[model samples]
Target: MKNLFIPHFIYWSLFMTSKENYHKVSILLSIYKVEDYLEECLDSLLNQSYHNLEIVCVDNGSPDNCGKILQKYAKKDSRIKIVTLKENRMLCGGRNAGLDHATGDFVCFVDPDDWVEKDHIKAMVDAILTKKDSLGNPYNLVLNRNAVSFMILADGSLKKMYDFGETSGEKTLNDVNLNVREDTEVPMWGRLYRKSFLDAHPDIRFLEGMNTDNIPYTFKLLAHMKRFYVIKGEENATYWRRLITPEGAITPVVLWKNMEIPICFDNLFDYLKKHHLAKNLRIPYHWFFTICFPRHKDQPRYYLRFKELMKKMEDTVKSSDVYKQEDRNLCDLLLYAPDFFNFMERYFTPVPVRISRSRIKLFGFIPFWYIRHKERKVYYDLFKIPLFKRVKTDDKEILYLFHFLPIWTRQTDRQ
Candidate 1:
C-alpha cells in the first residue's frame, strides 16, 4: 500500500513556493467544538482585505459540527485549507497541526471562536515588510491590539470595546514598571510571527497538557526573538468572543494549573538559567515569586516553596546589575508572610491541597488588595493611572465613588 502522508521536504518546498508566490500572511485557526461560532470566524477570515492570504484551519476532532463547517469552507474557498484530526488533540496539538500546514511567510494563530478585523493581516504584514531589526532581520513578532468585547447574537452586535492597549511588546517582559507575571504573558493569540523564526524553534511546540500549553512554548519563542513590533491605532481588530458556555476548556481546577501560577516561574527560571539568559530572567522571576505568589493562600505549595524560591530569586536579582530596591522589598514581603518558614514548607510540598470555595474567593481578592496596599506606586505606574484620580462627573462618581470613599460612607450609600 502507498503511504498517504507527504514527505516533510516536499511539504516544506511546496509551502516555501506558496509563500514566495503569495507573499501573504497565514491565518492558523485551531477549531475544536466551536460550531456555534465557526462560520462567523471563517467569514471574518474570508472577508479580510489582505488578498494574498492562506487560511489553515485544523479541526481537533470536534464532536460538534465544526468539522463539517471547516469542510464546507475548504470546499468553497481554495484559500481555506482544512485538516481534520482523527482524534481529539487539545489546543496545543491543534495549533501545531495548523502550523505544520501553514504556507505564508508570516503566521497568526486565531482561536476558532474569535474573529479578526478586516485589516488585521494588512496591518501586521505591512509592519513586517517595512520594519527591520538591528540584525537586519524583519521583526519576528508583530502584536496587534486585542479588544475584549462580547459579540451578542441577539442583535448580531458587539458591546463597547475594552481596549487592552499594547499589552505585548519587547519591553513588556523586561520592564521594571510592568510587573507582568507569567500568567499574563502567555496568551497565544493577537500576535503575528515570521514562519522562519517558528521553523528555527521546532522544539518550541506547545505542551500537550490541560492547562499550560502556551506558556512554555511562548517563553521559548520570546527568548529567541530579536524584534517585536507593537501596532497602535483606533483600527479596532480581533474580536475575542467571550462564550458563557461552561463546556469550554477553562475550569476552576484548569485555571489554577493554567495560570502557570508560581510553578511556571520555576520552570522558566530553569529554562533561562540553562540557556544562560540570567539577566533576562531576573524581572520575571522577581514578579513571579513576589507578586503572583502572595495572591494565592489556598495553594499551600506556593507558601511552602516560598523560602527556597525567594532565596534563589534574591541571589539571581542581587547578582544582576539591573536589580532594584523595590525588587528586594517585594522579596522581603514574601519572606515575612505569617509563619514564614512553616508556610514555606507546607506551601511548597509536592502534594496538592484541596482548595475550599471560600478560600478561593478570598485568595482571588488578595492580589487587588496587595497591589493597593503594598505596591501602590508600582501598580499605578504599570496601569498608567494616577493614585486617587478623582471621578469627574456625578455619573462617574456614582460608578467609582465606592472604590475611593471611606468604608462607612460607602456602605451607607450602598444601603
Candidate 2:
C-alpha cells in the first residue's frame, strides 16, 4: 500500500539485472559407482568462494550408494542439484544429463573421484572475467595451468602432477596455437567455457564410447573456438586430479583402443580440408602418430592394426585434394612401407632395457645408453614409458619420457 511508485520497481529490477553480469558457474559432475569419492568432490565445489555456482551431479544409475550421497548434499545446499538416472549411460550420457539442467554463465566439469583446491573456482572465474574480446565481450573459454594430478602410492602417500612455481598469465587463441600445434594439454576439466558457446555448437559433444574421445574433441574444440583465455592458476590454487582409481573404476582393456584411429582423424581432417585448414591440423596428425600412438607398440599385433589404419589414412590423403606427401610424411611412410616407420619408431623410441635384478641390485638407475636393441628383439624392446616425439629446441633434441623423469636428452651425454 505504501511506496507504489514506478521508480521503486525500476530500481529493484536494475539491481537484479546488474548481478547477472558477474558469473554463475555451473559444474557438471558425472558419477557411476563413485560413492566413496562423490561426497568429497561435492564438498570441494560447494565450499568454493565463488559462491554463485550451480553444481549438477548426475548419478548415472550407479548401483552403489552414490545417488543417496548426492541427495544428501542437495538437502544441505540449494546450490547442489542432483539428477538420478535409472540406468547406466556411461560418460557421455552422464554429461548430457547434467547439461540439460545447467543454468549458468560459465560451465566446467569435475569428476567424482577428483577434488579441487579451496580457491580453484574463484581463481578461474576471476581470470576469465579479467579478459575481454575486441568487441569488449568477455572471453568465451579459459584454460587452467595450475592443475595437479594426484596418485596414491603403495605406502598411502600422495603425488602431485606438476609443481607450480612460475607466474603465467592470460592466453589468447594465438597463445594456444603455439602449444596446441605441439600437442598441449587437452583434458576436459581445469578450464571454463561459456555456456552459450556450448549451446551454439551441438555437434561438439564428446565422442561416445571412444577411449581417446578427448583426443578428437580437444583438438576440434580449439579449432572451432574464436575467442579464448587462460586463467593463471599456477600462482594460485589448482584442481587436484585423481590419477588412481578403485577396482570397479579400473581402465577397461581396450582393443587397439580402437585400431580405427585413422578413421578418427578423418572427421577432423575433413573439417580442416573443408575450411582450407591444410596447414592448421598437421601438428594434430603429428600428435597422434608420434606423440600418442608410438607407445602402443607393446604388442606386435598393435603394429599390424596401425599398419591397416595408416594404409586407410594414406589412401585418404593421397586421394584427397588437401593433405600433401611432404606435410604428412609420417603417415606417408607408414602408408607406403609400414615396416619402415615401425623401424624408425623402434630405433628412436627404444625401450628402456630390462636388466637382471642383479643389475638393479648393483645400479639404482639403468643407463639407457647401454640399451642397444637389435634384430627381432627390437619388436619387444620398448621404453617402459612410451617416448614422446623428439622435439628440437634451438639446436638441441629433446626426448620426453615419463612424467616423473620428463626430459631425456639425446645428445652425447646428459648432465
Q: Where does candidate 1 clash, by residue pair? A: 300-347, 301-347, 301-348, 304-344, 304-347, 304-348, 305-348
TM-score of each: 0.65, 0.67
- Pairing residues by index, what is the TM-score of model 1? 0.65
For candidate 2, lDDT tens digit of each residue in 322-415? 4445435656555555375565664466456563221111265653322223221111113343333344445455554532233666554333
For 1-415, candidate 1 gives per-residue lDDT tens digits of: 1344557667867877763455767888777778888898889889887767789888888999998888788888999988889887777788888888987888888777776678777777777778766566678887766446453534555555355555443433454224443224425666788898898877667655334555566666666663476666665355464543434434333343334445555566667677777566344545555445545545556555654566667677667765677676556656665675655664456644432211112455532221232211111112323233122232222222224542221212321
Looking at model 1, which ten-residue stretch has the lowest summed lDDT? 373-382
lDDT of all predictions: 0.62, 0.63
Clashing residue pairs in all predictions, respectively, total: 7, 2
